[model samples]
Target: MEASAAKAPSTLAKASRERRDIVSGEVMDEARLIRFVVGPEGQVVPDLARKLPGRGLWVAADRVAVETAAKKGLFARAAKAKVQASPGLADQVEMLLRRRLLSALGLARKAGDITSGFEKVSSAIQSGKAAWLIEARDGAADGRRKIMAMARKQQSAPRVFGLFTAEELGLALGGENVIHTAFLAGRAAERWAEDARRLEGFSPLLPEDWREEPIEAKREP
Candidate 1:
């Protein structure tokens, strides 16, 4: 009779099982990795790959988590010592998040996935191709209202975000200066939307009337 295939040793099987157990927990979960560092006030600021100096602390990306962390000294606990928590740390994080969103929009413009000028943006909306409606925070109320109305007319009703000034928009789009822009869905748009949402969560400005509630808005007759 042909020789039967040799059975693996029981000790070898046990060693293999032990090796598997050791490697299981050794792997880091990407989803659990922290992307932001908390200030002493417990504001979660993006570490931009977590390369910043000093020990880092993390909090969830929400108002409740941030407020709870700040109120309870959770960050100090995480840092294992007392640290100065900056006043308005949340606002600072919001600003940084806005800048990141704008940067993503800039990348989309460079990649030809975005367009500016009122007519072009309007056309994009009409064609249901726009994924985001970007208007300058300092733009005229009438102009913004018109653009927003056009956006609503679109089949998809893309998200409208206004957190940057006209000058900032100009710098991003590489034009004389743009107050209105639209982004089509793609990698850039996805990144921008994520950043914008985070910024909105932490922005000091409450969402009510973007036009009528400006800090410097003048009363009209």
Candidate 2:
């Protein structure tokens, strides 16, 4: 399946942890699993934080796995109760993930850890302060190549994300035609990356080379 690159930030991937996939019956790290909590009203809800009440059920982060869990009554089986499942469960998860990711971006902006615009991003790249580089997928290839060239020159290479379109990125960062942006190294950027990775699994925003894997090892080179 075409998947978005959901690389985790350095703060959360120091060690690998495993969870059971309710659909595939395989054990994998949290990065590869999506948590679901049964709501008070018997509705199934996505709990990326894994802190929601009720027994948590895990499924592979892949959209197909989520759909299978909803379609094949896997959620009900895992919950061990008659639970309400959304036919658009994948869409809902994607929406929630996107919302959380954008909120994180806003937090990064408020913390003064974000830089947008081609010139600014290029500058950040040159300064080597960009720990996370984001480019709009719909943007011009020439511009992307230029920024990426800069990213490659950094001593600590930043994680690059191209999952969102120009309009989507603009809405998140509160600007028009926000084709390129970068997150300076910080806790906010880490949180933003974690959320984006979660959303990538449920959304059709991934590239053809995307793999079904965890975004862990935050401290690794």
Candidate 3:
């Protein structure tokens, strides 16, 4: 049974590699092929978790491949009957990507590679160990402005991100309240950046408008 089951995947992979069109059917490329079973109303869902209970349909992860599948009614054909493809499938994938990035950031914080609060973060910067800067989305603008200036002076100016809210940053850093945080480059930091880049197709950072004002020196409290 194990051999048979293995053969099934090999066969599917091989078949997907070859381009063939059935009568009154559309031709599909191997790269864009995802096989999934239809649920009620013939819903075609890509189970990224690979734990969904049903046959799965295969499709490319990009917008173009999804559109092609819809345009050619390929999903229904694959199901061997009529099936309904979910609306806004591409948006669903993007949401999953964002969740993945958040999880990675949380992991980095747990590994002690991240520090929070104005004082701790400033120390990290002064020590020349911080790789990325994290600011709360709803943090005080004046405070953020002050920090951005200090970051700019560093040899490797840290990229500031404001996507996560203050509450979220606080939770990650194990603090009651946190407005600023810094990540040190290492395994954890690298993983966080990689996930962020994959989800947003770039590093998450504070908007240019937010960084317009230069940070100024202030008396230490």
Candidate 4:
């Protein structure tokens, strides 16, 4: 008889694995932390992929924590050597994260795991096929409300994200006015969700004002 195959852990369980923060010295979910490394030039670099070829220096993903690490010379202390972390390190990390998320979205589109436009997205949500709802950060309030309303009617509403601008969404997905999109259930969708969650640490998935409404949905698979 063949031995039983092991099951893969859910994203929630995987994200729960802890990593120690060099700045605060607190152990927290790895997803809530950002990793860094010292370059050959002795400059601190954000290793968002956590695969850079050096010992990692982890910090909480919050802008304040990143700023504190840079301003207080925590990267040098962690690296045990002189390393330059620019004053605008936090801004740089945020830019990189935004780019990474957009690129991942493009890949999802190429993989045919995404449906764009208001009509198709509405269909995806109504049919319970979408696992994520991607709304442009600059999208109109009426459009957002309509999508959220449809999501609320679902037994398992898709997680909503408003992290990219309409132009950015268009450029990434190769369409004009790509204000709303939906990620169908698949590996590509899962990958995009992972990057979106990582970027969420640096920025709110939805605007703070949206919190007053019932917008959130099911957790990641």
Query: Which candidate has the top score in lDDT?
Result: 4
Instruction: Mark the regions of model 3 whose C-alpha exceeds 4 Å error after superposition.
Output: 1-85, 202-221
Model 2 ranges off by over 4 Å: 1-18, 203-221
The total of clashing pairs for model 1 equals 0
The sequence of per-residue lDDT tens digits that candidate 2 reaches over residues 103-205 is 7776678779989999998888788788788878788877877777777766777877767788987887788998889999877777676666666677544
lDDT score, candidate 3, position 79: 62
- Candidate 4, 1-221: lDDT as tens digits: 13222333554466557778988899887667888999999988998888899998999887889999999999999888999999999888889988988888888888788899999999999999998898888888888888888898898888888878899999999998788899898777776666677666667788776643645643443
Question: Please, what is the TM-score per model?
Answer: 0.68, 0.76, 0.59, 0.84
> What does the lDDT read for residue 70 in candidate 2?
93
The 0-to-1 C-alpha lDDT of every candidate, in the order given, reads 0.63, 0.77, 0.64, 0.83
Between prediction 2 and prediction 4, the one with superior TM-score is 4
Better of 3 and 4 by lDDT: 4
Residue 42 accuracy (lDDT) in model 3: 65
Q: Model 1: residues >4 Å from true position, as ranges?
A: 1-34, 38-56, 204-207, 211-221
Question: How are the candidates ranked when ordered by TM-score, highest leading?
Answer: 4, 2, 1, 3
Candidate 4 residue-wise lDDT at 187: 78
Model 4 bad stretches (over 4 Å): 1-18, 208-214, 217-221
Q: Summarize candidate 3's per-residue lDDT along 59-175 as a digit string, tens digits.
A: 644455666666677877766888776656656655665566556667777778888888888888878888778888888888887877788888767666677777776665567
Write out the backbone clash pairs for model 2.
Answer: 3-206, 4-206, 10-218, 13-218
TM-score, predicted candidate 1 vs. hidden true structure: 0.68
Q: For each candidate, C-alpha RMSD in Å?
A: 11.5, 9.2, 10.0, 4.3
